[model samples]
Target: MSLRSYFLSSAILMGAAGIIGASGPLQAKAHAAEVSGQPQPLPLPPALPTARDVSYGGTITLNVNATDLQRHILTMQETIPLPPDVSEKGGDFILLYPMWLPGDHSPTGTLDQLAGLKISAGGKQIPWVRDTVTVSAFHVQVPKGTHQLDVSYQLLTPVSPKEGRVVMTDAMVNVQWSAVSLYPAGYFTRQIQFKPQVVFPAGWSYGTALRSDGAQSGHTVTFKTVSFNTLVDSPIFSGKYFKKFDLTQDDKVPVTLNVMADRPEDLAATDDQIKAHRELVHQANLLFGSHHYDHYDFLLALTDKLGGIGLEHHQSSENSGPRGYFTKWDKTFAARDLLAHEFTHSWNGKYRRPADLWAANFNTPQRGSGLWVYEGQTQYWGYVLAARAGLMTAPQVEDALAEVAAVYDGRQGRMWRPLIDTTNDPVIAQRAPQSWRSWSRSEDYYSEGQLIWLDADTLIRKLSDNKKSLNDFADTFFATNNGSFVTSTYQFDDVVKALNAVQPYDWATFLHQRVQDIRDHAPLDGFSRTGARLTFTEKPSDYIESYSTLRHVTDFLFSLGFAVGKKGVISEVLWGSPAWQAGITRDQELVAVNGEVYDADDLKDAITAAKAKSAAPITLLLRDGDSFHTVSITYHGGLRYPHLEGKMDGLGAILSPLSGKISVTDHKE
Candidate 1:
């Protein structure tokens, strides 16, 4: 790859070509061969693709039957109305299975699940072949009299939760078109139109943002003809037990809440939560100053039997959570900002998308290098809208900020890996399990993303002398002439320009430094800007407890630099934590502490006990590699946890955003 090596190879190739030209012309060539036997430059892979046409050749009708949940199978049949122009090229036709699904951020379409796939016309089966190179494509030669084609296939659903929880069940089902449909390959997704119909299990109710015609007898429903893009974006949920709630107010900006649960009691939400969701809608409109959907549907699944999903879309979101999602609202923590977060996506992700991510066809994989803005910015707004809507208290927000700082403050990965590098992990890693996630740093961009935007929001307030905030950036960046659903793409410079327009600064360098560089410390400057500083206290913050309880896991993660999951088993040992130093490793069981039975609380007490007496180390009986050994954790930093404390007279500025109350008190900088 050196310059001298490159020139040497180029001269040698030129001399060989000249000698071959002087001798004779080669008359024969083989597949993938160069005539003169010299190596050739490889062809590049496909880049970003755009839609060639916006009009469809004709409407295709697709019908699916997914009522057989016990068998975990879905049957699909489609009628293609092929026009003359479609077969203008050598009478060869190509069909494409949906790939690179929007919002899933990868080519997660269930192609391997396809079974018994066949295409036919004129009462005879047409011979078809799967393209060797592009596995998602099928090629068929149309006969002289063939004017249309019929396709049939059976889609196998996942029987296990780990494979994917998004499929169907006897109680309820999630219907994603990408799993059961295919379309002509020549046209763009938005140019291919489809009229879809579904027959669900009898006596089940379903909810989707798709424009529906009406429900027919016994669980059959039909949807209006829509572009392939729109149909794929619209997913449906059907449940034997279902309920609907209206979170709308004054008939303006209608936001509907559709809940489908496994049990009857789970459908009931308290009046207070109902009111807060309506306020969530209000704060979203107030913050972004725009609406992009005709009407929004917040489809929620509260289940223990089904897999969990939180995919965002243009008109609705697929949000599923643990059992007792509503009945145990007091103890369950998912409801706080689940709806608020997805609603923000309506404007930030679905309406205004990153330019590279806005591929005209689902065939082209969306480059996730910009998800730092797409998901990260939305995550920032999710927490803000939650607090503003009173779903989370001001204290909770402070605690959350503290945890964010403590985490990134010691994130071992940031020592080598930059925050921006995490954007493409969902695709690169296929969202797979990781052994050393802290060191590998799968997706710190979501949390660190919040920090960067937080700093910007605080910077805007300081630069404008409290004249404006991120609200200006939000309104200007997402605004449109109407609230109708439409998409506009933006680049990194567009975001920088918008931030600069709100309050002038070298935002380009500011962002690049925070995101594009590897730093030893966390981005804690957002705290000082908000008039607060991050400090650790002996007691755990509300954010820490809430996060741990929700995940059903505990974090000695920041404290001892280790985390334990269910049954007191060590899930991970941080690279340089007290646990790791003491020789505890992942998959090892914390059997006992100080000759007492081990539990999360017992470990905490032992740590506290070690601090009480400097000579006494926390003794742990760990089950490591099929053998039990006693280990000692010798550290004096007794019970350390993160919390945000107000800086000199800066409490007002910090509390204003959290509580929405203007501070009456004033003080020094």
Candidate 2:
């Protein structure tokens, strides 16, 4: 019977049956009770008070004891003064831990690590409740005649990498104020004052942007009063082995490089290393033509124990390097550009912020629509400045760019997701590992955005006959309000305006096409405009070699479409590649290749042999979970890695240092 006729007949029979059954009262009640229960959503509780642009009326005193190295606990005591109005009529008061952290570009506050939270007023403990909607907020009823409240908490710093970032180690400690302090609600963070102090382990020197109030008494040090915003931005990096090097240029604003290491010998920096860092400062000034902070500090930690960081701030940056950063400078070229990347943020991200990214308080959500300019342009200048400062050779930077180009070009996710949308990955993915990273792109804006800026730079040079470049844009956009660290927020229109002022063009349409539109291919016009071509070769570039050595991975990305780490574990598998076509995945063990024990060199040999013998498939034994299987990959492509070939005059010009004299002042703090 036809589906329609069958349903119609069934409905008629059911209706007839219902009529016959409804003759009895019990049957009629049973037929009426056929409806399923549906529940409505309950109303959410009221939101916490919104921050107002007004003063908090009193300075908050925050004391942190960070000497617990064994347990990695930061004991915090905060004294908050109550406003006169709040003291007279006690009502609901709210305190917030930082949620939307600056530079993280997401709500990544370590609220889970907060423990033993207690609040008291007038020497008596007061009850508090956490806000249901915003867990970061604490709601409390203030008692009448209460002038102040004493808050105490302990931050359980992660001891292992699996838990979270290890901020405290036996020899060093990184104290981020946002993790250990609470601010009152209903006032702008900039309008709330804070008097901060920290007690560290004995004989451990510290580096921070916060100016010291006086001489340290034993292990305790107090800093001058600053707004809560600045307090959070200025973090402390203290260690037993510490050294400070001055990279100040022309004796103008002071720029210091503070180094902390795992051992005392790791602080041994050669004269040339120091000169390169000084040149980094000089090149940055030559590019932006201004300085934002009165004094800037580069808090560099050279250790393998502390959690790695490259976070930027207005006056200082938190950075990490290998234990052999200065001791083995030749092998550390892959990480040389970290300082440049963070330093550029002083102008791009801190001084000139995205309009939607600026928040009035720590609890406010920040939109990442402008991170393409905030982080992307910074990435562009990072490599450029690294080359210009002699930290990395021009060829090395070119090789680095070649790798970036290859990765984005091979990214299949671009067919569906645009570069602009990846800006949301910080919140969407929180940087968690993905099963198909190449297919599901994660934060392509950093490198892909770098390519976009390169496109703009080369286009500007071509239009202006090499008379103007992105340097002019930087000078016009970021150099404003020199010596002032006050944030200047900008929107999309401002970026386009600045670029047009540098070189007349339809920047809005250009940016829209590259950023907003999803395309199958990455933007490679920048390399072509510079007379360079991205090509694959059997030999890996020096940069790629260093990368593999540093990361402890073997790359067959272009051939087998996967990278193998130690013990023959597949770290990544490119989507739609031969390995992927064979149903291979990441985290799987390549137990054997072509009936032989799995080895990086052996696999390369197998791929090469397969290239010569087209009919012979590369057999692989893989282990997934508890299951083991064998598969044959019919890929004939030999080992291939990306490299740049042809003239790179335009790129060379972009990386060459501007003619200037660098004067350095050596000092120890």
lDDT of 1 by residue, 242-326 (tens): 9888877543556788889888878888888788777777777666666777778888888867777888988898888766767
Give the residue spans of candidate 2 off by over 4 A.
Answer: 1-38, 661-669
Measured by lDDT, the strongest candidate is 2
**Candidate 2, after superposition: displacement of residue 388 in Å?**
0.2
For candidate 1, the per-residue lDDT at 36 reads 56
In model 2, what is the error at residue 42, expressed in angstroms?
2.8
What are the TM-scores, per candidate, against the unseen true structure? 0.88, 0.93
Candidate 2, TM-score vs. the true structure? 0.93
lDDT of 2: 0.90
Give the whole-model CA lDDT for all candidates, comma-separated: 0.78, 0.90
List model 2 lDDT by residue over 1-669, tens digit each: 332343356567766665566657866555566444444234455567788998999999999999999999999999999999989987677899998999999999999999999999978998787876799988777888899999999999998999999999999999999999999999899999999999999999999999999957889999999999999999999999999999988957889999999999999999999999999999998788777788999999999899999999999989999888888788889899899999999999999999989999998988999898999999999999999999999999999999999999999999899988999999898888898999999999999999999999999999999999999999789988667868999999999999999999999999999999998888999999999999999888999988887778999988889999988889999999999999999999999989998988888888888877545999999999999999999987788999999998988999898886534342211
Q: What is the alpha-carbon lDDT of model 1 when measured against the actual structure?
A: 0.78
Clashes of each: 0, 0
Off by over 4 Å in 1: 1-51, 86-90, 621-631, 647-669
Tell me the alpha-carbon RMSD of every candidate. 7.5, 9.6
